[model samples]
Target: MSKTILITGVGKRVGFYLAQHLSKSGYQVIGTYRTPRPELQQLEALEVQLLQCDFYDIQQTEQLIAKIKANNSSLRGIIHNASDWLPDSDSACSISTIEKMIRIHASTPYALNLALAPLLQNNPLQFSDIIHITDYVVDKGSKKHAAYAASKAALQNLTLSFAAKYAPKIKVNSIAPAMLMFNPDDDDNYKTKALNKALIKQEGGEAEALRAVNYLLDSGYTTGQTLKIDGGRHLV
Candidate 1:
């Protein structure tokens, strides 16, 4: 029987590519998106199920897990790719904005994992996995983007906590990626500068992200570890 995987915020970019690639790899994919996007119709046409659930809403998060559980289907894995990148101006860096960032990036995943722990434990499959997509900036710490970095740092800690608690049954890992698929229309100079910072001196793409996921899934002995797909960005 084919395994089922749920990918949150899979309407575009890395999340979308993950859903598409995993589906092609023979896993049944259920993708969640906040707003309906026409591009996702292609995934639906390919028989990938699409569900609308806003991670920002706690009640909706619970309902989404409940609906999946009611189907009597066991989830093979979950990829938390949902994230918000709201830029904060000098005046707008208030408590509310920080709270929102924490709620969306850190709290939501933590809550969802707690709520779904029983379902994960009940899976008949002996091996299961969870991949949390985090940003490379968490370690470097962006000067202007403090909230985003702080939230992701908290998330990184949460990933460690979950992995330690869940143990040998459920493997939890994280992928920290840098400069993957920026706006196509942007000039090459910016891209070059970004690439130069990496040890590989080349910008990464969707394939690197997929590789991290595949590694985590295949490496049964690995947990509580983060695979950085940043082309050595942290080296500089």
Candidate 2:
């Protein structure tokens, strides 16, 4: 039987690409999108089951898990790929805004893992994995992007915490990517500065991030590790 994997935020960008890649590789994909996106239609056409989840509301986390449980589908893996990014400027970094960031990056994923532990363990296949999509700046901290950085840092720690709690049964890990894709409105100077930070001196691209997902899904012995797909940006 083909196995199903749940990937959140598959409406566009990294999530969309990852879902596309995994679907092609033959893992049945159950993807979640917060809003309507053209990519969601494409995913549906590709036979990927779509779930609409708004992570900003904590209540929706349980609602989403309940829906998944009701489906009675066994998950082979769960990729917490849904994330919200806001530069920490005057426009951002407010208490309410930071709270939303924490909910999306840390609380929601934490709740989903705990709530769905049973389904993940029921996998007759080798090891079911949970991969949290975190940020590379987590270790480095951010003066400007405080809200985004701090919330994702919490998730980075949760990856380790869950790894220990669910060890030897379900594997939990993370992927932290740097400059995987240029932001839509970024100028040439902005792009150049971002690229120059990486020792590899290039964007990691969607493939680099997707490859890490494939690794966690395939490896039985790996857990509690956050693979950096940052083109050596972590070194700087």
Candidate 3:
């Protein structure tokens, strides 16, 4: 039987692509999305089990954990890819903004890992994974997205802690990427400026992220480390 993997925030973007790729790669994918989108129908056709979850609500998160535990006796991996981009400059409640960011990016992953570690332990291959999808802003603080950056930083820090706690049982790691792809609505000036920040000078694409994820899953000795796929943005 193909091992099962759970991925959060698969409504679109990298998370969506990961779910699709991993499904085709022979893993049983169980994905979560906060909001319904047409793409989810495609995933369902591919045998990807979809769940609706809102990480901000603790009850909803708990219910998701319960559902996973009830359905699967074992899991091979989990990818925390669900995220929200909220600039502090936005006219929202300041405390709410920070809290929401932490809740989705940090709090949700923390809860899921603790609750799902047992399922991960039952992997037939004896190697399980928890991969956090972090952001490049984690290294360089963002003035406009301070809360978002800090939350991702916290998620990265969890990689170290969970790696130690799980030890020989499960491996915990992170992937930090910058501008994997641009939204269709982004203008030319915005794209040019964004591309200029990366040494690679292009959208890194979902393939880059897939490569990083595959490396971590296939490795025997990699844990507690982050694969930086930022196109060398830190060098700029």
Best by lDDT: 3
Name the better of 1 and 3 by lDDT. 3
- lDDT accuracy of residue 3 in candidate 2: 79
Tens-place lDDT per residue, model 3, 1-236, is 32899999999999999999999999999999999999999899999999999899899999999999999999999999999998896665988999999999999999999999999998888699999999998989899999999999999999999999998979999999999999999999999999999889999999999999999999999999999999988888
Q: lDDT values of the candidates?
A: 0.84, 0.87, 0.94
Please give the clash total of every predicted structure, in order.
0, 0, 0
The residue ranges of model 3 lying beyond 4 angstroms of the native Cα positions read 90-92
Which segments of candidate 2 are over 4 A away from where they belong? Answer: 89-93
Q: Write down the worst ten-residue block by lDDT for model 2.
A: 85-94
lDDT: the better of candidates 1 and 2? 2
Model 3 per-residue lDDT at 149:
97
Ranking by TM-score: 3, 2, 1
lDDT of 3 at 35: 93
The digit string of per-residue lDDT tens for model 1 on 22-98 reads: 99999889899999988898888768889899877788988887887776456788898998886666675577677
